[model samples]
Target chain A: MPKKHRLKRVFGAEERQHQTELLYNLTYAQSRRIGAVTVKITVEIADFKVTKDSDSVITTLNLGSCVGIALYDPNRKIAGLAHIMLPDSTNALDNSNPAKFADSALALMLQEMTKLGANKAALQAKIAGGAQMFFSPAGPASRIGQRNADTTSRLLRLYGIPILGQDVGLNYARTVELYSKDGSVVIKTAGRADKAI
Target chain B: MELFTLSDVHYEIMREIGNIGCGHAVSALSKMLNKKVGMKVPQVKLLEFGNVAGFVGGPENTIISIFIGISGEINGMILFLTEQPSARVLVNMVFGTPKNTELSFSEMELSAIQEIGNIMCSSYLSSFASLISKSISQSVPDMSIDMAGAILSVPAIEFGKIAEHVLFIESVFSTETDNVSGYFVLVPDLPSFKKIMSALGVD
Candidate 1:
């Protein structure tokens, strides 16, 4: 059986259609051909991806209170991006996905990068998102954006990974892209100029 | 009890709750806009963290959202979301501007939108509270114009700390113009879910 037929059989018609739409938005494969090969990977909420492909561009979209951390080893041309929702995993009721928390996600991404021939000493980070999004009185549920940024910074410092650039602590959403080739991070927001950090 | 393990009966009850809540909200909106409003049947679903963004188009789709915190008998959040065009239409209706007038959410307009959301939420909560014989209050409404996924993440992260899945009571409301439609989502936490079920005399 063809691959498409097998996927349809497993996922059914509706799921297959949804997957196709996701693929179209994620890859833009036909329209975004840079040179002979260009790979695009989308990191959804509470997910992480690490790649050493020089032609790859990894992206995470609509980061509200959540933070997107991009770590790149310029020496090895390896890049890793993690979209984490919360500050810590210790208090999570379901801690199955390590990528959902700042503390564990950074550690996991670093480990993955090192496994793919990236040097820990040469890893640098670029971070974005962590917007407050909405206003609420001071409480445990408030300032989640600040907490996520603080936790991510603290963990990176402890890991000896310097944050080279960042765009955080605002009142809007952000879309982030990390390029593996040159270790550049771009931040995009609605009705605003794209910033390269 | 786990949210995903809820039975069909529980979902049916949830559907009724959504129906009543949205019915009240629609009337409130209709009164505010002085236009005829209609609502689709409410949908109650237990959704994974990742799929919640799909409800309002997609993760990257830009939208106008209002957030209100629920307290008192239960603790949770309510989100009101509408596309840019729909938001423009609603704002225009409020200001009696031409239907095609552009809206950049000026201070006056923002406050108007916030008030609209506040009234709609209060009506929905009032109906729900009365139905369950509970007293619930809502926080001041906060508004944001951003990507749907970003707006949704606020509630997703809050709920993620307590459960793997979110139980959402989703209702879509539209006006006679048909170009104006909005989504209202109610997300109750695990303990609150239990409280609600028991209050409704359901196990």
Candidate 2:
């Protein structure tokens, strides 16, 4: 039922036989529905991706305790995506990677988008991820998911970017894709309905 | 004994620590399952947080995991992970194959596996703490059937702020029939490794 559990199912012998076909179909469905050609650029943890190609889709996956922020400029048809791990860099010992923290990650995304001819004044943000995957009692990680989502919001506000939609701080892993063609973000989680934010 | 750049001797020290900790945990697991278990030498490495899941499978790979967080003089998380087949084998051994569904694990079956994880994590931390003469305790074990990437990212996000690279050790435990094989991943916070080295009085 859950996407994670579905992954486990594919490991079984009975399902293993058809797993490849199913996965292929699923991936094929993500990009092509008939004649539409879509190119995917994935953003990993602490990494950011920006695209100006109208048919480009930037995606980030497996956001458990991490946050994925997507920025789009409708006028310029440019999208930037960043998958950040930590909530803040204020007390962090190392702040070398601008895309590693929620605060600085927003800055990096904005800069990259601007470099790609996106107007800072016309940017809209959408975010997903930051789910506390497991329950922990002795805590340094209890509410990190919420904290990360919250921090991403504060930083986006500071940049004067209005977040159009968000799906965050739940108990499921979320994969988000930002399509530059329409400046729309599609959120996918296993066992739940897909959402367009 | 730098955080990311540990000398071979330091690696040896960390490996020994892993061996000691895993030894006790597997022994406890053996007692619970009433079977003999063997463990591989823990694989120790300073790895990028993003690639940790790629070691087991991909970020999208589904895994059944039991997680426990450690706190006190040191901090970290211990993960007990296995594929669906291994989980089914382990659960079948204890619960007699979940009469209704052969494909999925029930809540009760999941709880049993969580108990195993709780025991293993407790033994591992207690054994290591006593060995180093330091005080440490663990939180309640939490169970999840999720993506390996999603499961492993919790610790990375927790520790990534302090260190870009994580010091992790993974050991595989296998039984005679090979039904109960499990992967145990221990991730200690960067600063805690230094404490461990100093407490052990090893360079």
Predicted structure with the largest DockQ when compared to the true one? 2
Which candidate has the top score in TM-score? 1
TM-score of each: 0.89, 0.88
DockQ (CA atoms), all models: 0.50, 0.55
lDDT per residue as tens, model 2, A106-151: 8777878899899999999998998988888556778898889998
Residue B89 lDDT, candidate 2, scale 0-100:
76
Chain A vs native chain A, TM-score per candidate: 0.81, 0.80
The regions of model 1 sitting more than 4 angstroms off are A1-34, A138-141
**What is the C-alpha interface RMSD of model 2?**
1.3
Model 2 residue B189 CA deviation (Å) reads: 1.5
Reference-based lDDT, each prediction: 0.85, 0.81
lDDT of 1 at A160: 93
lDDT string for model 1 (B2-73, tens) is 776789889999999899998999999998888899999999977777888898898888888888888887
